[model samples]
Target chain A: MWAITRLLAGKDLRVEMRSRVIINQVVPFAALMMVMFAFALDSDTVLARVAPGLVWLAAMFSLLVIVQRSFALEAADGALDALRVAGANAGGIFLGKALALAAQLAVLEVILLGAALVLYNSHIVGSGIALLVGTYFTATAGLAFVGTLYGGLAVGAKGRETLLPLLMLPVVAPVLIGATRATEAALGTNGATATDGWPWVGLLTLFAVVFGVGGTLSFGSLIDE
Target chain B: MNPLINMDTRATSTRFTSALGLATLIGLGWLAVFGLFLSPNDRVQKTGVRILYIHVPSAWLAYLAFVVTGLASAGYLWKRTRSLTLDRIAGASAEVGVLFMGITLVSGSLWGKISWGTYWTWDSRLTTTAFLFVTYIGYLAVRDLGGSHEQRARRSGVLALLALVEVPLVHFSVRWWRPLHQQESVAKGKLSDLMLFTLFVGLVSFTLLYVWLVMHRQRVAALDDMVDDGGLDRALADRRSEGMP
Candidate 1:
């Protein structure tokens, strides 16, 4: 188990550094999202109203693209078949895939944070920065737990790109609402408090536990089909 | 690619059809007819409340279909039997789920226009049903994502498991938060003996239709598999000799 974990994690990180595939896909999308949101706002004042939602919504959309690439890379050239033959448990595979997703999403959020700060003149580097960054990870951890599973499912289908958002959007509603509300509160005119960040954390923790464990146990069987 | 081929001669599926499919078809017809005729109109809303006949049943069956999809998904992941029957069952349920959910939404909106003076309420039941409908559409969409049969089955099982989380959330969202939809405590509130009988008949009949359609769909899927296996040309040739279309 330990060997498999290391192998899976090492592989993703190695390829990520070599190809920089995640950053290549993610940075441009986050930049474009901020530019689009900037155009949508009629005035600087209205930016505050929609800022939190746009930040996370954009982050979520970018994360979807990263998740797709993460699996797509594995599926090419028998890389996934190699992982399976390496004696990796389904649990290890799930854990590694989710970790790769988490890594990719964390980077995406960083780019988004930079854009939000510049575009909206939102304050950073204090409680708000901590809250926004923390909740972003929690909520997205929950999102990636399931996203990798479905990303795998979509491996060979026609129209996979079109099909993914249709499947993912409704299921991601909780993350959408929770992340939006949490980030909004953190960056709000209101001062930061644990109250703003903790509940979102708690709910997301529950989500991660249920789906994370379920995916671990079931991951092996899914690929066999 | 011949779209329609006769499946009656297929020998592998005969045993499975007898258990649940036939009994339900008879029940659906009886209930739908009786409920349409016998139930009295609501006192406050008058005849507009009659739309509940479609709304409630469609809502019920929609949920039932998703539940079946989840179970089939679980079964596929666990047993790895590659049971085409299970995938076919999951597909039918998702299709029916979307269909019924649509009826519930449309009929509910019509009821709302008269009852609430607005065409839409975002009411609790209506909101949940709409969200649930979207979820199933996602289910169907995800099942088509990967190119190969193996890819479709694996990915769909994963998506099904993930989406099932929303089922509980949608059902309980009303209690968890305030919403525009209403609370449904009973099947239209302590239905009288006749109403109860009608409701039973309705549930049974709808369930029957669900089964019959599923059977026919499976047969079609099986024939498609055969054609993909190089049987289509042969079957079409056989049919041409008999001068069938």
Candidate 2:
């Protein structure tokens, strides 16, 4: 199971690396969103105040793109059917795809964080670094697991492009809420202490674990037909 | 023709369904009288509190409907209990649930404007309920994504299960995010007995209405599946006949 997971994850990563879609298209898109937010809000104070939310919102929108790309890759070439015929463990396939998505999202988030700091002039408290990192890790994992799960559901369906976000965004509300609040606390904005961030991180972790285990168990049945 | 397939063309009525519909109609009539004219208004909210009769029941029935959807979806997913009937029930309940949830949101917003001086709030319950509504709408969209009945059931069943699990997490996360500055109570204080009775009537009527709607909607969905299957069967038969000649 672990071997299949690694092999699949590596294959997805290699495809992503060679294609450079994330670097060329998605990163610039995320940055453009941050800049757009700055223009829309039109205030340094307001932008800094809401920077945490804006950052997560941008990450989430980028998540939609990356997830769509991930599943589209499999479906375009009937790779999913091939994997099933190859008799690879379904759970491993789910985890592998989620793992690759998480890795891509992690890099995107780092750039998003940097973009937020530079564009919005947002400042992170020194002592809250650990909390900030924790928020990114747990929230990214939750988003990746859920995105993969729903992506699989929508993969072969009609109008999947529109359907995936509709299906995924509402379900990811917890991650958005938890991540935004946690990021706000970590950045010491909205008068939230670093201590306030931990609970939100816990919520993100819970979301990740529930979807991770559930998605693994059910992915086979979902993609079977 | 398959007897089961042939049966789909018949009207989806029975003695029990007729009885249920009649009870729902009578209950709704009684509820309207009690809720609108008979119940006393609160000292604080006055007439604004009247909307709660519709709003509360709609919200309650919506939750109940989604729960039914989840259970039916689960039944379809489980191999031992799998059936298209369960899938139809799931889809029907979700559609009704969305209707009621829309009523809940619109009425709640109107009520909020009357009382809170705003049509919207970042309140946890409101936000979480909105999330729930959207999730199920997506479920319904997946149902319409063009597939065989079993394909629809399998995909949507997984989605229903996942969405159900996310509800609590969405609720608590939103709750903790804001920490609810207002008391968030249904009423300012304890309700008068008459008011309570009216609310009870509302709940009962709305629940009966939900059952009636689901029963009819499930039948409609079954007929829909039959038509789809019938079309495919006919097409196959035509192709086979051409080859035979």
Candidate 3:
């Protein structure tokens, strides 16, 4: 199972390396979003205060595109069918695609963090950095699981391009809420306000576990012809 | 009795639904007369508290609708009991659930404005309810994305079950985050006898209304299936005439 997962993940990454889509297209899009958000708020101080939220919004929006792109790669020339014929386990495929998507999101988050620091003059060097990274991965795991599952479910759906986002954005609300709050805590802008950020991390972890396990178990059913 | 011998399932179900609808209408009228005109104002909220009659019941019904959707979804996905009937029931309940969720949010917003001095609050209940509304609206939207009946049912059933996982999380998120919305009222025994009675009447009536609506909606879905099949037949006939395989 692990071998299949690694192989599939490697396949996705190799394809990505050759195409350079995430580097060339998605990263630039994330940078553009950072500048757009700064302009939309039109105040450096206010933007700095809200930088955590802007960063999360940028990651999630980018995630929607990455998820779609991952599935779109499979749709070309029936690569998904080839994977099935090659005897890849459904669970492994789910995990591989999700892992690949999560890896891409991690890179995107790093780039977006730089953009936030550069554009909004946001600070990240603090004890809350641990909390921030943990929350980002947990939240990304949750997003990647659903995004991939829904990507497959909606791939053949009518108005699929529009359907995927509408399906995903709502389910990820808690993740956004958790990631944003946890980011705020890490940045010390809120100063342990309302509740400490750990609970939000706990929520994100719960989302990650639930969707990760649920998607793995159900992927076979989702792809059944 | 042979199961298929005399079963006019739609006719029988339609008759039963009409009776339930009539009972619900009468019950709602009773609730309105007592809740709107008879129940005295709260010391704190006064007349504004009356929105609870509608708001609370809608909230309860929305959850009930989703639970039904979830159960039917589970039935559809499980190998032993999978059937189009379960899928139709799941779809109907989700649509009705979305409708009640909208009512819950709108009525709750009105209630909040009078009491909390704003049309919205990030209170756990209101926020979660809004999230619930959006999630199920997306559920209904996914249902509309065209597919073969079995394909649509499988995808939708899985999605429904997944969405159900969020209900408890949403319910407790406020408690986990900050207590903005009021906690469960009936369970806490916070209401007086008359107020509780009014709430009970509203709950019972709304539940009946939910049953009636779901049954009618299920019938509509069955009709939709017929039309879809007809469309497929016409398409196939056209293909045959075009000398295509």
Query: Number of the top candidate by TM-score?
Result: 2
Q: What is the C-alpha DockQ of each candidate?
A: 0.40, 0.87, 0.60
Q: What is the TM-score of chain B alone in each candidate?
A: 0.76, 0.90, 0.85
Number of the candidate with higher lDDT, 1 or 2 = 2
Tens-place lDDT digits, model 3, residues B11-110: 5265667789889999999899979998888889988889999999999999999999999999999999999989999999999999999999889888
Model 2, runs deviating above 4 Å: B1-9, B181-189, B235-245
List the global CA lDDT of all models: 0.70, 0.91, 0.84
| Between candidates 1 and 3, the DockQ winner | 3
**Which DockQ value does candidate 1 get?**
0.40
Write model 3 residue lDDT over A11-120, tens digit each, in one string. 99999999999999999999999999977899988998989889999998999989889998887787887888888898999999888988899899989988888988
The TM-score of predicted model 2 comes to 0.94
- Candidate 2 lDDT over A192-211, as tens digits, reads 88998998899999999999
DockQ of 2: 0.87
Residue B97 lDDT in candidate 2: 98
On TM-score, who's better, 1 or 3?
3
Q: What is the lDDT for B113 in model 2?
A: 95
> DockQ score of candidate 3?
0.60
